[model samples]
Target: MTGGVPEGPGDDRWGSDGGWDDGSLDATARVVDADSSEEERRIEAALRPRRLTDFPGQQRVRDQLGLVLEAARRRQAPPDHVLLSGPPGLGKTTLAMIIAAELEQPIRITSGPAIQHAGDLAAVLSSMSEGEVLFLDEIHRMSRPAEEMLYLAMEDFRVDVIVGKGPGATAIPLELPPFTVVGATTRSGLLPAPLRDRFGFTGHLDFYSTEDLVKILTRNATLLEIEADPAGVEQIASRSRGTPRIANRLLRRVRDWAQVHGRHVVDLPAAEAALDLFDVDARGLDRLDRAVLEALCQRFGGGPVGLSTLAVAVGEEPDTVETVAEPFLVREGFMVRTPRGRAASPLAWQHLGLTPPQGSPGAGAGSQDTLPLSGDVGRFSG
Candidate 1:
């Protein structure tokens, strides 16, 4: 919707209406990217739950956050600066919108990458009205100067505006109306301690349960006016990688497949067919996901290879692989990122129908079938 959005549906973002994209093939994005494309964002808006009560997952976060809002309302003031920390696509931005809606105030949207300087941040903070909500996505990525400026703005609701050159510069004191800053970040640990301390409430979102994802898919199916069988809906939900954004995004693609094939309703076969067309395997691992595993197990000899080396083996940039594919792989136990480098778990070997060599990391652990579907191999590093 702004400068970074693709003019059409074919930019860095993928899997929107009007075009069929094999999401994992893109250089810098995936179908399930946390940084989704504009068209996908448009579709997502229609599917988002407008209120906290209606939000489908993260029930604990919802309950705790509800109390914060209610208490703020009673005091007739904006709630404390709230920080929502989690992986992308876990509804941080959606929750930010819901907060403003519940408070009945206007909300301003921006990202950490967009604010380059202290002056830029000062301008945004200065333009606020009382009780308004400023939703900052990827708040951890803000520039050092902007981040320092944010510390004061969050605590004191004021900013020091500098005028003139280095030595001649003057700090102009400016008071701001009391407003709420709702910041979302995937990497909260990167935030400076002083800045992190300013947030009154910090909520960490986790993956949705299979039941939650199913409920989400079913609700959106009716909203999108798609007649889908329970089997089709369940199939899609199972392979959704436990993320709501992915569940809804896949629904559209399956719907498109149904329409083209002259099927009046989506069934299990239809779901499978659509996913196959998109190169999504039964476990929701796309081509890129499998590529990373293959490179680790086959090419790198179950490496301990560097991320850069693995990315090169797969013909992708390191960041693209790290951001777009590695998280899910690490989360789902297909790979591991040790200090040595990236390595395949035993599950990764079995998934590729190969045996882990003797003494390989996790090689003695047994077959991939013996592994849990969502094991914690280790945290994926940025």
Candidate 2:
């Protein structure tokens, strides 16, 4: 699959009208710095798979989505509204763009936060042309009223436009053009039942495998004109937390390091040196991740600690710590979330090169001598 659109090297042209410059595409594409250069954004846009065949991983979703788009094309009708739910950076937005491209329809991108009121959503819905793709990202965050409006729009293709004050309000039924709504959310369970039911198709994206990520990274390296070895690509893929965005980001960082060190290619040593310079370990844990583990173990004695307290210990936001850090830590068995609070696991202690204290929940020791809270620190060699 050609990553949805066809473009060659130095082809920085980003679709008709430069879709990214309008500020709609940046919300999902900018994974690194908020102040990312325009060139960086262009490179990311160029990397996107324009068609379904080109998308990597998610075989089930790819096949199902292809069938949906193909059937819709055969009928000459708009495809059903698609709901894509998963953790961030797993290619929900990319799939949305591919849906539009496959249907040869234009896409209007926006987020739930952008639509504060029912009227806000109504305006966007009213303006869309027939068969357009309306991509509403973070749909769970939308206001209830707007969500209710969306329900009516999705089911009946009509919205009751209120024109005046409460008692004197005039209700006008407005007919909308046939359009496909592709909604993406990290927290699918948070969506109201009626809203969730409106979607005809739902796809849940999972983490990419190392082989899949290697394919993605290799494609990206070629697109970026970076000379990267297979080993270097594998090393980055293994440490990418199964995320394509992170793999691409690591590749860029490795490229930058190699350029700075007068190296012409991204070899194993270049990749390792660059990753070490950036503070990412072999197991893909970054500085913040290590800090959270360290705090939960040493500072809290491996006891159940509150998420907010842990975030405070690291001087980060509770949401950031929970959403960005806790998921992977919990998934990798480094931490556990109980009804009481968050707690470090035995693996966390082992990874940090420290022995778990006796009688602690994660220590797995029964009536043994208490180990020192400060054990010998060792460099992570994952």
lDDT (10s digit) by residue, model 1, range 1-382: 2322223454534346431132111112212346867777567678878899899989999999999999999999999989999887789988988998899877767778878888778767766678988878888999999998888888888999888988988999999989998999999999999988999999999988888988998999998899999999999998888888788888999999999999979899999999999988888999999998988887877878788888899999999999899889988878767656787888788788998766666576665543222344354333
Global Cα lDDT for candidate 2: 0.83
- Please provide, for model 2 over 1-382, each residue's C-alpha lDDT reduced to its tens digit, 9 standing for 90 to 100: 1222213233342334433322233223433346888887788788999889999999999999999999999999999999999998899988998998899877778788878899888867776678888899899999999999999999989899999998999999999878999999999999999999989999999999999999999998998999999999999999999999899989999999999999989999999999999999999999999999999889998757787788899999998998899899988978777655777777888899888777776677422223222232121111
**CA RMSD of each candidate after superposition:** 8.0, 7.3
Lowest summed lDDT across 10 adjacent residues in model 2 is found at: 373-382
**lDDT (Cα atoms) of all candidates against the true structure:** 0.81, 0.83
- Candidate 2 residues lying further than 4 Å off, grouped into runs, are 1-33, 365-382
- Model 2, residue 110: distance off in Å is 0.8
Choose the strongest candidate by TM-score.
2
Instruction: Give each model a TM-score.
Output: 0.85, 0.88
Instruction: Note the residue pairs that clash in candidate 1.
Output: none
- Cα displacement (angstroms), candidate 1, residue 311, comes to 1.1
Where model 1 places Cα greater than 4 Å from the true spot, the runs are: 1-41, 357-382
